[model samples]
Target chain A: MTTDSLKYLWQFALLCLLQVLIFNHLNLGGYVNPFPYIYLILILPISIGRIQLLLVGFLLGLTVDVFSDTGGLHAAATTLMAFYRPLYLKAQSPREGYESAAVPHIKTFGFAWFLPYAALMVIIHHTALFYLEVFRFSEFFHTLLKTLLSSTLTLAFIFLAEYLFVSTRRRR
Target chain B: MRNVLLFIYRNHVFFVFLLLEFVCFWLIVRNNNFHRGSVLSSSNRLVGNVYELNNNVTEYFRLKTVNEELALENAALRSLLNESKYISSGRKGEVKDSVARQHYTYIPAKVVNNSTDRRNNYLTINRGILQGVEPEMAVLSSEGIVGIVKDVSKNYASVISVLHQNSSISAKLKDSGYIGSLVWDGRDPQVAQLMDIPNHVELAEGMLIQTSGFSSMFPAGINIGKVKEFHVDEGDNFHSIDVELLTNMSTVSMVYVVDNLMRMEQIELEEQAQTDDD
Candidate 1:
């Protein structure tokens, strides 16, 4: 296997472990369930094949769903997010376009670009997740509040992780 | 055939995503008919084992509170025993003991997984089919009604907590014997709604609500909640009643699954009577 694939595999293992073990138990006043598993989908290399990306999203989500006992809500939402990642990238393509080998991260693309992309992904994922879990239009506002709060908290935690552990040289 | 193959080859990725989503949506939304589709649920062996391990460690931190609850239950049981013995009408103690034992069976279980925040909250207990816990059996804490057992596996069982939107329990006012049904509005864990009471039933705040014994799952006189506040909608003959549930659902660690010994016989007789009426 190539070094990039090896790196992603390790990242996948660590993120899933952290998500199920540490983040699932955080509670956060019972509303904000910060799903850092989305990070795995976000940081995939831009040129990776669609089939691999979709499969990874499904497995990652199903793993978290198993640990959290949420059934398949995570799997459904994460797979949808993976399907939309390419469109989101195309919508906000840089003037020079993306390098085929580049990974999407705050440092790699600068904070301005990374922030909106992550926000859109979080919004889509959380909207699908909260609505599907509740599955009622009567609680629309309540579900919306959960979606917004959880997305914000997830983005905050992702930012903190990126800033703390990532090396500057990797961005270049 | 060539055209179809060409289209399939071009759109395989999209179709694959669609197929995976269909499988996931089925898993998430469909209620399992035979319990085989949900190997990842908390009632399964692998997931249940992990939660049991986690609970084994965290249960230590709750020892003080748990002990207090157990002590209170012990006191209540002791008083009940004394009352039964004193009220025996010239019957021998052995016969009275047998009669008391036949009424209800309690299987004590520890909750290994619980969630109160969701729209449909469920509790996973360490007891299952091995312990004779069955679906539709009522569960109760020392304080009050917890929920009803929804599913049972080999070594674990899942309960549909009173906090669930779909949960409804038959209950009545203790003093006047006016009957109604209790249901959760999915808003607060502490409060639930008591419905189907006529406007003239005379419900007041703080009135005690208990199980009516009309259902075989729960016995009569089990404390459910107290009437908090109530209102009657315009042009409606029924009052909407709010109840403050007695059980602190968030902190419940130990629960007793109540298996009605004569439930099958009762159901059989009821069904027979229905056929005769027809």
Candidate 2:
């Protein structure tokens, strides 16, 4: 496999492991479940194929499901987020357009550009996941509150990880 | 046909997305059904091993609490031993030993993975089919009822915790004998709602609740919780009761899987009665 593809594969594995082992156990106030695994999809190279993106997203989420015993909850949510990523990127593209090999990272794009992108994606993923899990509209507002809280927590973790790792890699 | 093929080729991403989502939906529906075994759960060989390894590391931090719980349970068991109780010699043989047969057997297991925050929570334990654990068996901690086994792999099993929305345990008040179905409201991990107790029943705070044994899953008289609060709604026939569960689900690590030896016979007779009525 190409180096880029292999790197992505390693990332996929690491993120899945981190999610199942640590993030899934973080039940802050029994409401916020921060899923930073979606960061893999967020930072994937801008030029990655749409089909590949969806497949990777599905696989990553399925791995999490297998560990968490949540069936297809994560798989469905991640796939939905992956499917919308390209369209979101297109709509939010800079006037000069993205660099040829740029990955969507806080390092590449400033906080102003990256914050909204990551936040929206996390919000969409968490909302879809929590709703699909409950599978009912009876507690709509309650679920929405949970979704918002979890999304905020997830966004915080994602930003923290990006800042920590990306800056260190740049220094090297 | 050419136009259709062109259209399909133009939007293949959407089609793929639809296909994957459909598969995921199918899986979710299938997994939701009771007693339907699936390899996608934590009880799978690989997933179970991963959790077991993680538990090995975290288990050290919980050793103090675990030891305390074990000691309390040991003391309780010791108190129940024949040596600790003074039995009247005259009435000892009055109850024939042959009449009292063993009905439930408990197999001890360690919790490998557990979650209490989710709407539908589950726990994975180390014991499974290989250890005589099976679907529908009752799981209990030293303090009180834990959950019921939903699926079992060879070396691991997944339990549907009492906190789950689908979980409903048949329980009754210790003093007044008022039966109700205990269910979690998905809001608090420490409390659950007991339904179907009529308004006329004299309810009081701190009243003990225990399993009714109406269902064969659990033995009767196992403590579930105590009434924390109760109120009758306007024009309502029943009282809304909140129970403070004795066992803290989030901290439960050691559990026992209860095997009902006569479950098949009971089920067979019940099925026969139903069929005869029809």
TM-score of chain A of each: 0.93, 0.94
lDDT of 1: 0.84
Give the poorly placed runs of model 1, Cα more than 4 Å off.
A1-31, A95-97, B32-37, B83-101, B271-278
lDDT of 2 at B62: 99
Candidate 1 Cα deviation (angstroms), residue B107: 0.8
Indicate the residue-level lDDT of B185 in model 1. Answer: 75
C-alpha lDDT of residue B112 in model 2 = 96
lDDT of 2 by residue, B114-182 (tens): 998899999999998888998999999999999999889999999999999899999999998888999
Superposing every Cα of model 1 onto the true structure, what RMSD results? 3.1
lDDT of 1 by residue, A22-49 (tens): 6765655557677887888988888878
Interface RMSD, candidates in the order listed: 2.3, 0.8
Best by lDDT: 2
Candidate 1 chain B: 10-residue stretch with minimal lDDT: B29-38
